[model samples]
Target: MANTPGAKKAARKIARRTEVNKARRSRVRTYLRRFEEALSAGDAAAAKTAFVEAQSELMRAVSKGVVHKNTGARKVSRLAAALKKLGGSAA
Candidate 1:
Protein backbone atom coordinates (compact mmCIF):
# COMPACT_ATOMS: atom_id res chain seq x y z
CA MET A 1 0.00 0.00 0.00
CA ALA A 2 1.52 3.31 -1.11
CA ASN A 3 0.49 6.05 1.28
CA THR A 4 2.29 9.10 -0.12
CA PRO A 5 1.53 10.58 -3.51
CA GLY A 6 5.04 9.96 -4.78
CA ALA A 7 4.89 6.36 -3.72
CA LYS A 8 1.54 5.89 -5.39
CA LYS A 9 2.82 7.35 -8.61
CA ALA A 10 5.86 5.12 -8.46
CA ALA A 11 3.69 2.08 -7.88
CA ARG A 12 1.60 2.96 -10.90
CA LYS A 13 4.71 3.45 -13.00
CA ILE A 14 6.10 0.12 -11.87
CA ALA A 15 2.86 -1.60 -12.77
CA ARG A 16 2.90 -0.09 -16.23
CA ARG A 17 6.53 -0.96 -16.73
CA THR A 18 5.86 -4.53 -15.58
CA GLU A 19 3.17 -4.98 -18.22
CA VAL A 20 5.41 -3.58 -20.94
CA ASN A 21 8.33 -5.76 -19.91
CA LYS A 22 6.07 -8.79 -19.80
CA ALA A 23 5.00 -8.17 -23.37
CA ARG A 24 8.57 -7.71 -24.49
CA ARG A 25 9.63 -10.91 -22.77
CA SER A 26 6.79 -12.81 -24.37
CA ARG A 27 7.71 -11.44 -27.78
CA VAL A 28 11.29 -12.57 -27.33
CA ARG A 29 10.15 -16.03 -26.29
CA THR A 30 7.93 -16.28 -29.35
CA TYR A 31 10.82 -15.42 -31.62
CA LEU A 32 13.01 -17.93 -29.86
CA ARG A 33 10.37 -20.60 -30.25
CA ARG A 34 10.13 -19.90 -33.94
CA PHE A 35 13.86 -20.24 -34.26
CA GLU A 36 13.85 -23.50 -32.33
CA GLU A 37 11.10 -24.92 -34.50
CA ALA A 38 12.98 -24.05 -37.64
CA LEU A 39 16.16 -25.53 -36.29
CA SER A 40 14.49 -28.73 -35.21
CA ALA A 41 12.79 -29.09 -38.57
CA GLY A 42 16.23 -29.03 -40.26
CA ASP A 43 15.34 -26.00 -42.36
CA ALA A 44 18.60 -24.14 -42.37
CA ALA A 45 17.32 -21.16 -44.34
CA ALA A 46 14.25 -20.62 -42.23
CA ALA A 47 16.28 -21.20 -39.09
CA LYS A 48 18.79 -18.59 -40.14
CA THR A 49 16.05 -16.06 -40.73
CA ALA A 50 14.40 -16.91 -37.45
CA PHE A 51 17.74 -16.73 -35.69
CA VAL A 52 18.32 -13.23 -37.01
CA GLU A 53 14.87 -12.10 -35.93
CA ALA A 54 15.28 -13.71 -32.53
CA GLN A 55 18.66 -12.13 -32.02
CA SER A 56 17.25 -8.76 -32.98
CA GLU A 57 14.35 -9.11 -30.60
CA LEU A 58 16.64 -10.32 -27.80
CA MET A 59 19.01 -7.41 -28.24
CA ARG A 60 16.13 -5.01 -28.35
CA ALA A 61 14.87 -6.42 -25.08
CA VAL A 62 18.32 -6.04 -23.58
CA SER A 63 18.54 -2.44 -24.76
CA LYS A 64 15.09 -1.75 -23.35
CA GLY A 65 16.13 -3.22 -19.95
CA VAL A 66 13.64 -6.04 -20.20
CA VAL A 67 16.56 -8.48 -20.05
CA HIS A 68 20.09 -8.29 -18.71
CA LYS A 69 22.90 -7.59 -21.18
CA ASN A 70 24.89 -10.72 -20.40
CA THR A 71 21.84 -12.95 -20.56
CA GLY A 72 20.96 -11.56 -23.95
CA ALA A 73 24.49 -12.07 -25.18
CA ARG A 74 24.54 -15.61 -23.90
CA LYS A 75 21.24 -16.44 -25.57
CA VAL A 76 22.37 -14.91 -28.84
CA SER A 77 25.58 -16.87 -28.65
CA ARG A 78 23.77 -20.14 -28.07
CA LEU A 79 21.32 -19.42 -30.86
CA ALA A 80 24.19 -18.68 -33.22
CA ALA A 81 25.91 -21.87 -32.25
CA ALA A 82 22.77 -23.87 -32.86
CA LEU A 83 22.28 -22.17 -36.22
CA LYS A 84 25.83 -22.98 -37.14
CA LYS A 85 25.32 -26.60 -36.21
CA LEU A 86 22.21 -26.71 -38.34
CA GLY A 87 24.08 -25.24 -41.27
CA GLY A 88 26.87 -27.74 -40.85
CA SER A 89 24.46 -30.64 -40.77
CA ALA A 90 22.60 -29.52 -43.89
CA ALA A 91 25.71 -28.95 -45.92
Candidate 2:
Protein backbone atom coordinates (compact mmCIF):
# COMPACT_ATOMS: atom_id res chain seq x y z
CA MET A 1 0.00 0.00 0.00
CA ALA A 2 2.93 2.32 -0.56
CA ASN A 3 2.00 5.15 -2.92
CA THR A 4 5.50 6.56 -3.50
CA PRO A 5 8.72 4.87 -4.54
CA GLY A 6 10.42 6.13 -1.40
CA ALA A 7 7.66 4.59 0.71
CA LYS A 8 8.03 1.27 -1.07
CA LYS A 9 11.75 1.24 -0.44
CA ALA A 10 11.20 2.12 3.19
CA ALA A 11 8.75 -0.73 3.52
CA ARG A 12 11.26 -3.14 2.11
CA LYS A 13 13.89 -1.90 4.51
CA ILE A 14 11.48 -2.32 7.40
CA ALA A 15 10.67 -5.86 6.35
CA ARG A 16 14.34 -6.79 6.27
CA ARG A 17 14.97 -5.20 9.62
CA THR A 18 11.98 -6.99 11.10
CA GLU A 19 13.30 -10.34 9.94
CA VAL A 20 16.72 -9.61 11.40
CA ASN A 21 15.28 -8.48 14.69
CA LYS A 22 13.05 -11.52 14.96
CA ALA A 23 16.02 -13.79 14.41
CA ARG A 24 17.98 -11.98 17.08
CA ARG A 25 15.09 -12.21 19.51
CA SER A 26 14.71 -15.92 18.87
CA ARG A 27 18.42 -16.47 19.35
CA VAL A 28 18.31 -14.72 22.71
CA ARG A 29 15.32 -16.77 23.82
CA THR A 30 17.07 -19.98 22.83
CA TYR A 31 20.03 -19.06 24.95
CA LEU A 32 17.81 -18.18 27.88
CA ARG A 33 15.94 -21.45 27.58
CA ARG A 34 19.17 -23.38 27.60
CA PHE A 35 20.19 -21.59 30.75
CA GLU A 36 16.86 -22.38 32.38
CA GLU A 37 17.09 -26.01 31.41
CA ALA A 38 20.51 -26.25 32.95
CA LEU A 39 19.23 -24.67 36.12
CA SER A 40 16.28 -27.04 36.32
CA ALA A 41 18.57 -29.99 35.82
CA GLY A 42 20.43 -28.97 39.00
CA ASP A 43 23.72 -28.77 37.22
CA ALA A 44 25.57 -25.81 38.66
CA ALA A 45 28.49 -26.13 36.30
CA ALA A 46 26.34 -26.40 33.21
CA ALA A 47 24.11 -23.61 34.41
CA LYS A 48 27.10 -21.35 34.93
CA THR A 49 28.29 -22.05 31.43
CA ALA A 50 24.88 -21.44 29.93
CA PHE A 51 24.48 -18.29 31.98
CA VAL A 52 27.73 -16.96 30.65
CA GLU A 53 26.68 -17.60 27.07
CA ALA A 54 23.19 -16.25 27.58
CA GLN A 55 24.50 -13.17 29.32
CA SER A 56 26.87 -12.50 26.49
CA GLU A 57 24.16 -12.95 23.88
CA LEU A 58 21.81 -10.66 25.84
CA MET A 59 24.39 -7.91 26.12
CA ARG A 60 25.12 -8.25 22.46
CA ALA A 61 21.44 -7.81 21.69
CA VAL A 62 21.41 -4.63 23.75
CA SER A 63 24.43 -3.32 21.88
CA LYS A 64 22.68 -4.07 18.59
CA GLY A 65 19.57 -2.11 19.74
CA VAL A 66 17.47 -5.27 19.64
CA VAL A 67 16.89 -5.00 23.38
CA HIS A 68 16.78 -2.06 25.77
CA LYS A 69 19.86 -1.45 27.93
CA ASN A 70 17.93 -1.66 31.19
CA THR A 71 16.04 -4.72 30.03
CA GLY A 72 19.22 -6.57 29.19
CA ALA A 73 20.76 -5.58 32.50
CA ARG A 74 17.70 -6.75 34.36
CA LYS A 75 17.66 -10.12 32.59
CA VAL A 76 21.34 -10.59 33.38
CA SER A 77 20.78 -9.65 36.98
CA ARG A 78 17.95 -12.12 37.40
CA LEU A 79 19.88 -14.88 35.71
CA ALA A 80 22.91 -14.16 37.85
CA ALA A 81 20.79 -14.41 40.94
CA ALA A 82 19.43 -17.74 39.81
CA LEU A 83 22.91 -18.94 39.02
CA LYS A 84 24.07 -17.92 42.45
CA LYS A 85 21.24 -19.83 44.03
CA LEU A 86 22.45 -22.85 42.13
CA GLY A 87 25.83 -22.47 43.85
CA GLY A 88 27.47 -20.99 40.80
CA SER A 89 29.58 -17.90 40.46
CA ALA A 90 28.41 -15.01 38.33
CA ALA A 91 31.57 -15.05 36.32
Candidate 3:
Protein backbone atom coordinates (compact mmCIF):
# COMPACT_ATOMS: atom_id res chain seq x y z
CA MET A 1 0.00 0.00 0.00
CA ALA A 2 3.00 2.29 0.45
CA ASN A 3 3.65 3.12 -3.20
CA THR A 4 5.53 6.39 -2.93
CA PRO A 5 9.21 6.49 -1.95
CA GLY A 6 8.49 8.78 1.01
CA ALA A 7 5.75 6.45 2.16
CA LYS A 8 8.03 3.44 1.93
CA LYS A 9 10.70 5.19 3.98
CA ALA A 10 8.15 6.31 6.52
CA ALA A 11 6.82 2.80 6.86
CA ARG A 12 10.27 1.41 7.43
CA LYS A 13 10.97 4.07 10.03
CA ILE A 14 7.74 3.30 11.79
CA ALA A 15 8.54 -0.42 11.87
CA ARG A 16 11.98 0.21 13.31
CA ARG A 17 10.67 2.69 15.88
CA THR A 18 7.98 0.26 16.92
CA GLU A 19 10.51 -2.49 17.54
CA VAL A 20 12.76 -0.13 19.52
CA ASN A 21 9.88 1.16 21.63
CA LYS A 22 8.75 -2.39 22.34
CA ALA A 23 12.19 -3.34 23.58
CA ARG A 24 12.43 -0.22 25.74
CA ARG A 25 9.04 -0.86 27.29
CA SER A 26 9.95 -4.46 28.01
CA ARG A 27 13.20 -3.37 29.62
CA VAL A 28 11.35 -0.90 31.85
CA ARG A 29 8.94 -3.64 32.90
CA THR A 30 11.83 -5.93 33.79
CA TYR A 31 13.32 -3.30 36.09
CA LEU A 32 9.99 -2.66 37.75
CA ARG A 33 9.45 -6.38 38.27
CA ARG A 34 12.83 -6.70 39.91
CA PHE A 35 11.92 -4.02 42.40
CA GLU A 36 8.60 -5.71 43.10
CA GLU A 37 10.14 -9.12 43.63
CA ALA A 38 12.75 -7.71 45.97
CA LEU A 39 10.13 -5.86 47.96
CA SER A 40 7.91 -8.92 48.18
CA ALA A 41 10.82 -11.05 49.31
CA GLY A 42 11.51 -8.57 52.14
CA ASP A 43 14.98 -7.78 50.93
CA ALA A 44 15.18 -4.14 51.88
CA ALA A 45 18.63 -3.51 50.48
CA ALA A 46 17.87 -5.26 47.24
CA ALA A 47 14.55 -3.51 46.95
CA LYS A 48 16.10 -0.09 47.48
CA THR A 49 18.75 -0.72 44.85
CA ALA A 50 16.23 -2.08 42.44
CA PHE A 51 13.99 0.90 43.00
CA VAL A 52 16.79 3.30 42.15
CA GLU A 53 17.64 1.42 38.99
CA ALA A 54 14.02 1.12 38.01
CA GLN A 55 13.53 4.83 38.49
CA SER A 56 16.39 5.55 36.15
CA GLU A 57 15.07 3.16 33.55
CA LEU A 58 11.58 4.64 33.82
CA MET A 59 12.90 8.17 33.41
CA ARG A 60 14.73 6.99 30.35
CA ALA A 61 11.48 5.63 28.95
CA VAL A 62 9.87 9.01 29.50
CA SER A 63 12.77 10.70 27.73
CA LYS A 64 12.41 8.30 24.82
CA GLY A 65 8.68 9.08 24.55
CA VAL A 66 7.77 5.46 25.33
CA VAL A 67 5.96 6.65 28.49
CA HIS A 68 4.52 9.87 29.82
CA LYS A 69 6.56 12.00 32.26
CA ASN A 70 3.87 12.09 34.92
CA THR A 71 3.30 8.36 34.59
CA GLY A 72 6.97 7.79 35.28
CA ALA A 73 6.87 10.20 38.18
CA ARG A 74 3.85 8.49 39.68
CA LYS A 75 5.36 5.04 39.34
CA VAL A 76 8.59 6.23 40.91
CA SER A 77 6.70 7.81 43.78
CA ARG A 78 4.74 4.66 44.51
CA LEU A 79 7.80 2.46 44.26
CA ALA A 80 9.88 4.76 46.43
CA ALA A 81 7.16 4.73 49.04
CA ALA A 82 7.16 0.96 48.99
CA LEU A 83 10.91 0.91 49.31
CA LYS A 84 10.72 3.34 52.20
CA LYS A 85 8.22 1.26 54.10
CA LEU A 86 10.12 -1.93 53.48
CA GLY A 87 13.43 -0.43 54.41
CA GLY A 88 12.06 1.29 57.48
CA SER A 89 10.61 -1.88 58.93
CA ALA A 90 13.62 -3.95 58.02
CA ALA A 91 15.92 -1.44 59.68
Among all candidates shown, the one with the greatest TM-score: 2
State the local distance difference test value for candidate 2.
Answer: 0.98
Question: What's model 3's overall lDDT?
Answer: 0.90
lDDT of 2 by residue, 15-91 (tens): 99999999999999999999999999999999999999999999999999999999999999999999999899996
Q: At residue 41, what lDDT does model 1 achieve?
A: 95
Per-candidate local distance difference test = 0.92, 0.98, 0.90
TM-score of 2: 0.97
Tens digit of per-residue lDDT, candidate 1, span 1-91: 9999999999999999999999999999999999999999998989988988999999999999999999999999999989888773322
The prediction achieving the highest lDDT against the true structure is 2
Q: Give me the displacement of residue 39 in model 1, in angstroms.
A: 0.5
Which ranking of candidates, highest lDDT first? 2, 1, 3
Off by over 4 Å in 2: none
TM-score of each: 0.94, 0.97, 0.91
Comparing 1 and 3 on TM-score, the stronger one: 1
lDDT of model 3, residue 39: 92
